[model samples]
Target chain A: MNTELKLQALLDGALDAREIREIEAILAQDIQSAALMQELKWMKAAVAGNEAEVKLPETREFYWSKIERGIAAEAKQAAAAPAERAWWLRFIYPATGLAAMVAVMFVVSGGRTTDGADTESVPEDVNAISFRSEAEAMSVVYVADENGTFNPVGQETKNEPEADK
Target chain B: MPQPPDFTTTLDVQLVAFSQAGDMIAFEELVARHRDKIYARAFSMMRNEEDAIDLSQEAWVKAWQRLKQFQGDSSFATWMTRIVINLCLDQLRRQKRTRAESIEQLDEELGGVERQMPVVASNPTEGLERAELRKRIDKAMTQLSYEHRTVLILHEFEEMEYKQIAKVMNCSIGTVMSRLFYARRRLASLLQSLKKEQQS
Candidate 1:
């Protein structure tokens, strides 16, 4: 191969020592060869240039901790998963049951009716009344308490009428 | 006196065996052993130290997760290096997907701006010390595109075969050869130009 092709291959280590030496001799025979050789040598060095020292980054403990924890988790998973993991599931069920019970009690006990339904807080059995919607299709007829009154929306009675008196 | 065993060699076999058997500590030791080399390889490819470090760590996590597949066909370090290279390539491919590079348009290699480099008739490294030479070369290397820079690092520093570089780069061996060729040429021109500037 010509010097141009040989130069690249030589730097590539594709050309053996004998080929390199022969090229060196040929170049020694010509001045222009010397310029070409210089370019080739510099090119080789610049590419094959000694590498900068590679510094290993200092490791963070947090990174190691992640690996440690992940492995520990796997270890725990292997050793006794049903015991530890089941606790979380088991706790969820009972806690959910307690919350559901509280919700049910809140609905059934009718604790402290705040919507002015309490003005007539007379326990339903004592002075039972059913109020009907004006549509009557939804009868909410507050069966009139024998006391003769029920305020469904909780408006106050200002005064008794003469007829009632 | 009995010769001491090569600790790294011994440790590598032991760790690989332990890790294959599902020992997490053994895998961690392997990570610590090879992290720097893998990190450097990724950094060289990506040219972004932070991303390189992250990807290298991700590669380790993956390697540990997939330790079962390692058949021990190669040296552990070589196997690990392969993993890191694959991760870096995946990251590059992801970036390539988001980039606007048209393969058809980019195939044409321009002679490029370095071709017009001013004359540098003198030897740049003639009298400079090795440290200075390395510094200048590193600066020149930084000027190369990621594609070109990766080929040069793999070829020169890693001493990887062209076929191996092609695999790492996900390109044909011909592409590897061409990139190395052009990269070396541009670097030669750049360095000599830098040298000329230093001298004058």
Candidate 2:
């Protein structure tokens, strides 16, 4: 250790026997270090003997009242936090379950024939023909009008008047 | 629940257990029991009464929050003390951020000009009564920089070892030793000056 650290260790009684002997020999040879040792010893003794014991200036009740206020406030916040979370969860839990149920119903009931019949054969006089396009992944519904022409529900036929005109 | 023994006479461990179980009364008792020591520790580090009081109370609030985490490794007071010390350190750090840097602070970091002075030969406290000595020490403590005062308080007043102080201060053992060495030397110098002032 360096000289200052060695001296500190010596004062702290932290030195092993060999280090203690070394420091002692140095102290005997060095007047400055010896004086430092004397000063440090006196200082340590005085401080250890007379460390101040200060009490809080406020009355005990007054001081504790502040802490009690703090605790109460924190406890209230703590209690309120869980309640607020539970309120949100009350709404969120059913919403999430509803979404899951809708997804499951969609998965179970999607794209199935309701009756036990082949879907390819159209009824002889049926006016609406629904076409499923496998490549584009879309279903198109076409209705046959009085002229026996099929028209997609949303698209205008040739005889329709343009609204903007 | 066996009517929960009077909190005033309850031991710290019992009080802590009750506190963990959400008993505010037990925590209030703990606060009353150790408030002075905790406040004194904060005051020793912060050297400001308001800051000490705030920090000590904050430490108690923290203890209440973390009561369940108290695994009985150390005494509740010691654990509480560590919390207060941490708060004081954080308070000091915040204050330090706004503090102006000065040549004097630099000098203190480098052990100051006092490190070169001839060592005082006589015991400065030799002729004083115990009460007077304590008063003088308290006055001298106020004059020290936070780092020096903190190391002295930890070593002398708190009776902490260098390693423990190092851990608390979050510095190396060598830094603790150097700080303690400088603190003692500075305390000795201050006491000598105080003695002279008294004589004059």
Leading candidate by lDDT: 2
User: How big is the positional error of residue B168 in model 2, measured in Å on the Cα after superposition?
Assistant: 1.3
Clashes of each: 11, 0
Error of 2 at B199 (Å): 1.3
**lDDT (tens digit, per residue) of candidate 1 on A90-165:** 8899999999999998889786344523232245555455443333223332435557685453542334446866
TM-score of each predicted structure versus truth: 0.59, 0.74
lDDT of prediction 1: 0.69
Instruction: Compose the digit string of candidate 1's lDDT tens values, residues B1-200.
Output: 97633345556888888879876666777777877788778877787877877777777766776788888898888788888878887887788778886553264244233334443456666777888888888888887777788778888887788788988787887677667666766777778788779769
> What are the runs in model 1 whose C-alpha is more than 4 Å off?
A1-6, A15-38, A46-49, A66-165, B1-10, B100-122
lDDT of 2 at A141: 73
lDDT for each of the candidates?
A: 0.69, 0.83
> In terms of TM-score, which candidate is strongest?
2
- lDDT, candidate 1, at B184: 68
